[model samples]
Target: MGPSTIPAAVDAAAERFGDTEAVVDGEVRLTYRDLRTRVRQVAAAFAAAGLKTGDRVAICAPNTWHWVVAALGASYAGGILVPLNTRFTAAEMQDVISRSDAAALVVATDFLGRNRLAELEELGGVPEFVLTIEDWAFTDEVDAAPVRADDISDILFTSGTTGRSKGAMSAHRQALAVAAAWADCGAVVTGDRYLVINPFFHSFGYKAGILVCLLTGATLVPQAVFDVARTIELVEQERITILPGPPTIYQTLLAQPGCDTLRLAVTGAAPVPVTLAERMQKRFGTVLTAYGLTEAVVATMCRPDDDAETVSHTSGRATADFEVKIADTGEILLRGPNVMIGYLDDAAATAEAIDADGWLHTGDVGVLDERGYLTITDRLKDMYVSGGFNVYPAEVEQALARLDGVTESAVIGIPDDRMGEVGKAFVVSTRLLSTEDVIEHCRVLLANFKVPRQVEFRAALPRNASGKVLKVVLRKESP
Candidate 1:
């Protein structure tokens, strides 16, 4: 059986994989034993700083050795971790800190060549006990706090559909369960090396990336910033065996060199072109697709035996012991051990999300095939009707992704005199293009209603920190 709580997991890793290298952060190689020792020291530091049980500890930093230690250390000290998005402005950071009521703030001194702490202070977000993530250590003698499996471990905020972020609190057992589920799906094993490209603030990085490594005894290699050249160097130098990210990550890497050494690759946000899936299968021995959200870190995942076409078209069947069902309305509902406790302190919203039947009503709409594989259609909110027929923007966007020179695109519904509502696409391209270039291309791939009625090309699309397109922002823009 796996460890019950996260601290217990760390301790188990020390005993089980003691001499094995746990982390590789550029000249700082730590064995599992050393990792546990550092975690205990940082936990003691948190206690010395007057952190109380159940108190919230907010961390604002990039993915690094410091972020891993600080987050794990906070949990070891009986504190709830609140990881803030590095892309957030000072005001957004202050808002989350106040909302979570974080008692202590651990932040990076500098990132992106800016003084992060200074910006927060300038915006009047001074916490009671502030410390830099780089220097979070103490030698004071203190017994490590005991954490029950039921205890709250972290409050990860997710901004879904509404554009406003909500804190989704998860217990120790739930977090570990989700990570273990993901690890099993990806075939993660001891002695494998994983390069975490996802941000630490998101559940994909924190749970699936970090905790998965801790559970399977894989070495964790963190990259502070994602530069294609730098990432290639890390893969070669560390001999990375596993890589996972969004489809865009693989798309960009396909054009770059030195990624042929990867043994496994995982990606989501589907409608993955069979072409790209085939390319990834050539470079990586195994490519898997998964579907997850903040509430349930991992629900369904394609297996190693799954083919490239299966990985491209579907997110695979449920693997985390999650019960996947389609409501009569076509919305996806999940019930499993990995579901979060609830949205932090929002009883009404929680009630609306999880029914008395114990199923969490996922706002996403999807389809389940005969073999139990799942294919996400689109968000219930994002779906629009054109000429008395329903249209999913993801389908149109998938068609757009296939067009040459069309790098990224987001589609929203616009008011149409004849159809009442029609699709409008905001595209990011590699070369010059006109509206006819996009419309004519879509006419061949999609039906008349599913085609975008108008097109706008921009240098970039507005995205949230988690890398989701801000369709709400696009809806607010003047056509």
Candidate 2:
């Protein structure tokens, strides 16, 4: 209902928790006062670097307080923060930066440089200034001016499974609305320690972890990468109350030798297997299954106070201030203030995604029950045709997840001269699962056409920051 920019919100939190630890990353610990000061310094540096209001600054980093500092500083200086996927190639990075007309970039020193950053330096259309997290130096004189809620705070790119990524411009008001919906209704309390395993380059990580911590005055435990043993230890050591991650993350953490310290485990991005959810609740605590998209930041979250049955089955109820509807085609469309201001610089996509009535067409197909809980069955774009029979990848992947050795699976439609388009599976398993075993498992549940024509086993499947299986990466890696 009101403006909630990063600077204003952090200023409030600093006043309340100045001496308290606001962030912990390995050996580094920053208090609320220290974070506030650094954010202002970065804002001042951006201003000194000749950045103006509404300019875009891309961030390619992991889950560090530096990423938060850069993002919050950009918001404070009235610049649009564009988060670049750390997995992307140099060409991909150049395309996004050039397309967004980014004035500068704050990149990770060694994490994302190996792929294509060196090539980006040689190529034209580079950002005016490139600063790394370790080498960034900022002054004390930053003129913190008031910013309008209508100003675009960040541009998160989500171009779907295919094609180039589109920058989803999110405003200060929308970001705050998402945070408020979660805090007011989803039970994220102040002083709650949120273990952020997801990368800050993603909308899920930015809104769910960083913004939520800032809004609730929660301490942020920023882990650079997801390691089951380390994550569990952090939860026990820090007494982390809120653990937000993906299905794969939950599966791995639950399998860890010792991980019973978490008070609440919140999962999203992919559907959670009912069996895994049950096991988590029976062993650990309640593991709520939530569903959301980059378009809306986070549309639905399974409340922390929900019963085991509710948390295990549905994506829980819509948060306060949002409406979820099941379209005639079983598509999930959302209407809310948390929805983004359409795709950046793409009017046609903006028109297609957000309708005239302000509903966001979330490209996910699912249903809403009598109790108003939503269940995402499949992704509309991930559905493919095989021998005139329609096949949903989620269906096949779900079946694969049930197998004993299968840790993760990704299904895609590869070219098949015989069947036109045949289903192919790339799987990651704890132990090597034979192709015959995977095929037989799928054959038992799905129709012949829906079953994967070929099953390939890998030590680990490619995944994005949100833990969503990277079908594109899988397709590329497949022989």
Candidate 3:
């Protein structure tokens, strides 16, 4: 048979890996058999509650077994699952719920308590049906449902690194393609246990972390939050074979007291600074970088067998099923089954993002090296013209991040009458540093035009739930 949909994977695992542990929390453990049963029951319940095909169902919660079960249930019931970031403000939360026209919301009682639900209900546009994780489980009756490959599976909203948020609509076939690509690239096999630190709310988290577990019969160990010490404990205890996280996560875990038992570690979300990969390899023996987004799922990932230089320097070779190229203007364009259909309810963005040739304009500046490795230079939106020269913020930010006493940095174009626009920097640091410090650092590695004209200190740069720096917010408040 061809590849199965997300629900079909649950069915196959239910029989093949029945008694094996599929999900594990600190004190809670569930076998595949039980997990599948819960998913079916939840699907039945959601169906009985008037959820229909193509309806949008939103889930706002942290990493937990319930998140996986609810998401799969929605997929099985032929509804579009919308995973909302838990860190969103009340306004942000309402905005997404309204924009997506979600018909129902499945939230965790602990995460989106009664007060938040009341607040969300008060918002004029939300769908009437709302159920907490606890309530959904306790329901007395539910009905059965099924899904097809082309059915819409999820709507993942991403606030462009510089623009307003847009929901990327992913179908079941596309979601399944991600799992297939990940397995082929990483050589993932049945029985491999993946530690899931990234939240399931993200497309990367759902497709790479949870769906991989379902398709490959791998076990999933879920964590509520990223605690370096706790992750080490789980890794050693669970003997987690595959780990996908950002460089910051790996860095923190490498610093943890007992981080020796991991077999494979994949880092992404932000650039994996060269030095960070070296430290991880020296400490844990397995370190690789992954590059992906909410729109295209996982387009590229470094293999575990790759050398430190490859892991540190490149985002990794493009996925086997995907095509990557540098547009004339340096933007990264992708063509593959992994690319989402389009942004939901936003025709303008859909037209702007995809062209007649079917390539999804990723809008991230990148270079395809002679070896076929892809190195992301910066966000196309984040690239600014300084004195008529194109300046990439990632290059300047990386240089500044490497400076002594600099914790994090962001570069943006600020108005300048003489030069038209010039680079300005916002820094988060503890030690005293000046604009000269950042300017000198960039001078050593970058052109004079790319260096920051001014540097300002802040306690910490504004970041979204996924820990991505919000340059959009930064530019708004710049002096």
Winner by TM-score: 1
The CA-based lDDT of model 3 is what?
0.77
List candidate 1 stretches off by more than 4 Å. 134-137, 160-162, 251-260, 383-479
Report the error of model 1 at residue 20, Å: 1.1
Using lDDT, give the best candidate's number.
1
Model 2 regions more than 4 Å off: 1-3, 112-116, 251-260, 282-284, 383-479
Arranged by TM-score, best first: 1, 2, 3
Candidate 3 RMSD to the correct structure: 10.5
The TM-score of candidate 2 is 0.78
- lDDT of each structure? 0.84, 0.76, 0.77
Per-residue CA lDDT of model 1 for 1-479, tens digit only, reads: 88989989988998999898899999989999888888888888889889998999999999998888889888889999999887666766887899899999989988887677898899885788998965655665455588899999999976534435578999999999989998888889999999998888889899999999999999999999877678778888998999886566677777877766688988764356788898888878788988887888888999988888899889999988999999999999999888889998788777887899889988889999999999987666786756434466777788799899999999898866445578999999998899999999887655466789889899999989999999989988946
TM-score of every prediction relative to native: 0.80, 0.78, 0.78
Candidate 3 lDDT tens digits, 1-479: 53557777777888888888888876768899888778877777778778888889999878988898889888777788998877655456788888898888887656533355655666655567887866655444243356778878889987654335689988888898887788767776777788988778876678888888777778899888777678777888988888877565676677666656666787754455678778877776667666677778888878767788898788888883888989899989988877888998888888888888879898789898887788887666876655434466776777787888998888898877444468999988879988787778777655466678988889988989999998889888986
> Which of the predicted structures, 2 or 3, would earn the higher lDDT when compared with the native?
3
lDDT tens per residue, model 2, 113-175: 352345578777778777788787776757565787778888887654434467888888788
TM-score of 1: 0.80
